[model samples]
Target: MKQITKAVIPAAGLGTRFLPAIKACPKEMLPIVDKPTIQYIIEDSGIKDILIISGHNKRSIEDHFDRNPELELNLEEHGKADLLEQVKAIADINIHYIRQKEPKGLGHAILCAKSFVGDEPFAVLLGDDVVYNDENPCLKQLIDVYNTYGGSVLGCQTVPQEKVSSYGIVASEATAAERIFKVNDMVEKPAVDEAPSRLAVLGRYVITPEIFSILERTEPGRGGEIQLTDALKVLAKQQNMYAYDFIGRRYDVGDKQGYLEATVEYALRREDLKDNFLEYLKKVVK
Candidate 1:
């Protein structure tokens, strides 16, 4: 089994969900209070030397991670050492970028990292969803499963059966490990009535190198894009793939409601804001 050393972040989506604001600024660069959403993705990635698949207006993702010496010097002059460190932290990460050329799909964006990933098993973190778990990052937990299974592991969690239509779901059988299950099949965004189970894939994947070839042959699927779900389906049939009901509070930061909820929750968790923010919330809700 190969060690998972690299990560592929499929950040090429047009982010039409947050349009206008996203028209000028890339959605991945949208901040969750203090840090951009992509920064949270990187912090939870647990793997350095990332290859970010970008497209169209996503240059901000690259610029955000590059050194801003002028900004640094200005902060230094003002003696804002703590703020300066936060700015420098991203610049120091080993990040590489590539444009997807077209807004293909999640699978296509990942395929764009073929040369960078080479033959190693790599983790994929979608920019839309941010899983917060300081004790065990979602992607890192998936890596542990890959190390044990030597195939692929889909980071999943049970969603309401009615909501299964929004995500790719698994046909699975439970394994001895509490929340883990062996994936027998994958169904991409099926109708609620047609869904096999509620084990919805949560977009954190530790995929084997074999998937690059599988994705190459996959035609554009749901929404005329080369869906990652299709490629993973093939991999499951060929070898064992597991779906881990990972530990975390997942925030779908791409959606307005989810983003607002995540912001409030994340803010509540902050030491500086907990007391004041909680009091403010109590007053507002009354």
Candidate 2:
């Protein structure tokens, strides 16, 4: 397998859901706990070179990765050197930012990174989907399958039948543990009767560069925007595509309810807030 050294994170959406909060801040910069949602995706991917595709209103998202000398000094003065080191490490990762001139769609945002990705296979991570894994990193698991299979890999997870229409469903034969599958076909937001399989694409993918050509030729679909799934469908016809039932709990921060759930769940896991937060939750529920 070729060394997968680059990752593309598409954060160009207008984030109209969180209006006022997102008016000045990018949704990807929204805090899950102490860390921004995008940071979690970046850390989880473990890739050093990241191309962050942003929009006109999302410059703060890029600045977050840059050095903040004053913030570091404040942390050090408070005897929080550990926290200071964490802030310093943000600059250690190579982050490249490019603007999506228009609010086209996910496909357009990804197309903006074509130059940065060049001819190499790259990983695409949707900033809204936060995957939690206690063992292996979700992206690494997909990369492993890509190495063995030498094709595109989409990270998938089983969802209830009723929720199939909200995702890109995959039909595949189980080839290993619940974590892997040999995909036969992909259907975007298929109805229950038309659904391929329960394995839903969960916003993580390792795709070959061949996808660029397919995406370029793809016309606007639903919402009058180019759909990435459509491009993947075309690519699947010409090359092998596998879906790995990645072992992780994914939180869709794109929705209001899911965003709140992720914030509460992640906050409860933090040592700084766990004890008091759990106690407060118990009292409230009682």
Candidate 3:
């Protein structure tokens, strides 16, 4: 199989959870400290060609990545070489966008990328997920499994059993590697009492092209919208889908609490701030 060189990021949601704060802003553009969540995802995506599915109020995403010679000139004239280079770097990233036009669902957003994807296997990265891993990027891990198994691979993590209902759960037999599993079944947001296991699907995936056909037939499920989970369920039945328990800390930026945790944890990880931030946090807790 060819290396998956393309990625699709769905950022078209209305972000009602954040309400007025995100009223005119794209949630994907929300900053984690100095960087936007989407930038973090793409920075490590290992993909050169990226297609972002955007919806209402998503113009900022385009502007952020677009080259601004005026701003660059300003930063350069001010002797801010570091800042000037940073803006230039953002401009160099190969990312394109398509309008979703409506807040349908993840499945719908992905479908809009069919033309961009063509017949190649591509990655689906939700902007809400921010995973930190240097040695083995989360998406690279999934792609490794895809190359080995010749099937779709979903990024998964062990969530609390009680939180199983909040995510898609997987049932599988353990492989030689403890974290790799040969997935037998998957249920989207199954009730705790009905969940197959505590293994919850995270927002990263390297999917085969066949998924487009399955998604086309998948009906509106949970929110009266086409769901990626529903299509994956059918794909699971027809093909070999594996869930690799990826090694990384995943933050759900779509939730207020998760977003704050990502911000603090990420900021704490920076070398210059760790000591000071640690002292500040200690004082706040006290």
- Most TM-score-accurate candidate: 1
The residue-by-residue lDDT of candidate 2 on 167-282, one tens digit each, is 99988887765567777778888998889888899999999999898889989986788888888888888988888888877899988998988999998878889999999999
Candidates' lDDT values, in order? 0.90, 0.89, 0.90
lDDT of 3 by residue, 1-286 (tens): 9779999999888788888889888888889989998999999898889999988779999999999989999999999999898999998989989999887788989989999998999999988789999788999989988888888899999999889999989988898876899888888899889999999989999998888988788788888989998888788888888899999889999999999999999989899788999999999998
**Where does candidate 2 stray beyond 4 Å?**
176-178
Q: What is the TM-score of each candidate against the true structure?
A: 0.97, 0.95, 0.97
Residues 18-64, model 1: lDDT tens digits: 98889889999888878889999998787778999888878888889
- Give candidate 2's TM-score: 0.95
Cα RMSDs, all models: 1.1, 1.5, 1.2
- Candidate 1 local accuracy as lDDT? 0.90
Clashing pairs in 1: none
Candidate 3 yields a Cα-based lDDT of 0.90
